[model samples]
Target: MDIKSPLPFETSDKAHANLFNRMVNTLVENDNVLSQQIEGITNETLFILKGDQAIQDGSVSGEEYPIGITFMDIGQANDTGYPTRYGFVKNEKISNFRFVQYYYGTGNEAGNYFDSTGIWCRHWWTGSGWTDWHKLSGFLHTNIGTTGKQLLTKAEYQKVLFNRKIKDSHNNFDIKNNRFICPENGMYSVNAGVYIESFQRYANFELSIYLNGIRYKNIAHHRQRPESPSDTGILNTGLYGAANVPANKGDYLEIYIYANYEGDVSRYVSDKSGWFNYFDIMEIGGRNFPRV
Candidate 1:
């Protein structure tokens, strides 16, 4: 991964202009293996060659710029110059012969700053032309605080709030809202578990996973209590639930619990403690196929 950094360019310099144009053309023509960089004034408009424009792959002006991978950042490039705003192009031809684009500035429902948001897409080059772009989803894992969360009312379901994030690969998890917004169209693996503090008899608990405010699956529904009132040594158990949920982009998921006892519930907060209270989601598979 050789980096060509601080490669200065002047707008009025004809030699620099010609070199920049050639570099752009080189990026357009190359498939994968090399990357070139150009540092210049921000927000400069650059053209990308598409559909067999016959540009030389490693020829930049009179010099030969070898190509394996290409990377350039011309901040906020005009929409007229490229299909994706503020996105740089990278070509990678592995065994699949696919071109991949990893980009940010994707506005999300979780109110993530556009530049902080990111996603990846890829398409195949089928000899004739490129295929449609396929967007990939992100993964998320979050959990509650160490002190545990309390259910205020018995027999009434309430949204469980997770205040900590163990993993948020795509910035899709909203900790403040206790929801995971789907970043792309796909099926997700949803899993969550909670341990309620039990100090009474015949206490019941039910946990459900919700998709876009609708109950999608019940992960836990059971009763737990002490075996005997005189039994002083007893610890109740936690409930774990998982489901395969389908969601479109911008769709969100949440977890809710209904308990017959109104009290605090312990959650898995520390790996060393071996407690198991947490929520997790990951994109399994799905694609928006382009019509022939």
Candidate 2:
């Protein structure tokens, strides 16, 4: 560490005992290279580890090692403070994974558990053992605000209450039951939309995509007519769609709206600057469950 103590050994110059035996062998080779890099970081790379030091170093229930590189301060070990995590567990033949990666060290974010700072969670020893922290990044985008029209009916389908929440990283958007609740199992990537105010002539309009409540996906279907029998004028339309849905963990998603012109149709609140009626979900891909 910037070592330099050899200058004091000049007994009276005659190469001063061979420069004081090469400055005591360069201080015993820099003390054996700083004790083998501090014993490979305190015994094989555990540099600053501690969440009880993974069961005090035995490597969590020990089935055969594999638990180093941990760093936790969870507010000084569960004083219930929060922030500071960095883990990595592993363990095979019985599964056990871990992962973790946290931050948000200070400035007291004030919470009720939804500030994952740099978020990346994981956990997996299943059969009832360790399976809670599962946020591997899922997202949501919502929109809804209708103070006027909304009367659909080809005899059913009507659950598009998006309710407003733009960008939910892992809260899974459940604005009081206007659902989206899927937080694991993956493959999501849905995008939906709606905004039609009146189009009744041959009128068709349909936009669906609901999973836990069944109607799986009809994305959008619009059919308007007017340029024929002396048009009556009242036609505005918008329908959007995107899919890829596969979801699982508590699966729940919804967005419905039917039509065949059963009266009034959509546009309850537009002009609040924009966004007709939306719902975007995201989780791109992840699997390993009963999704075939």
Which candidate number has the best TM-score? 1
TM-score of each: 0.51, 0.32
**Candidate 2 lDDT, tens digit per residue, 1-292?**
4445454555666787787788798887888789778766653355444545433231233333344444433443332312123223333333344433232333333462333332334343434443333334323333433344455546466786666676665466777877888755556878887776664356777887889998887877887666552224566678888777787778888888776653443433133323666777766554524546
Q: Which digits, one per residue and each the tens of the lDDT, describe model 1 over residues 1-292?
A: 3533444455888988889977866664452233333333223323343334312221112111113344444245344222235444444434234444333333443653332344555444445344333444333333433235454366678787665677676567887888988766667888888766555456677889999998989998877655564223334557788998877778899988876742444322123221476787766664544338
* Cα misplacement distance, residue 73 of candidate 2 (Å): 8.7
Residue 157 of model 1 has an lDDT of 80
Among all candidates shown, the one with the greatest lDDT:
1
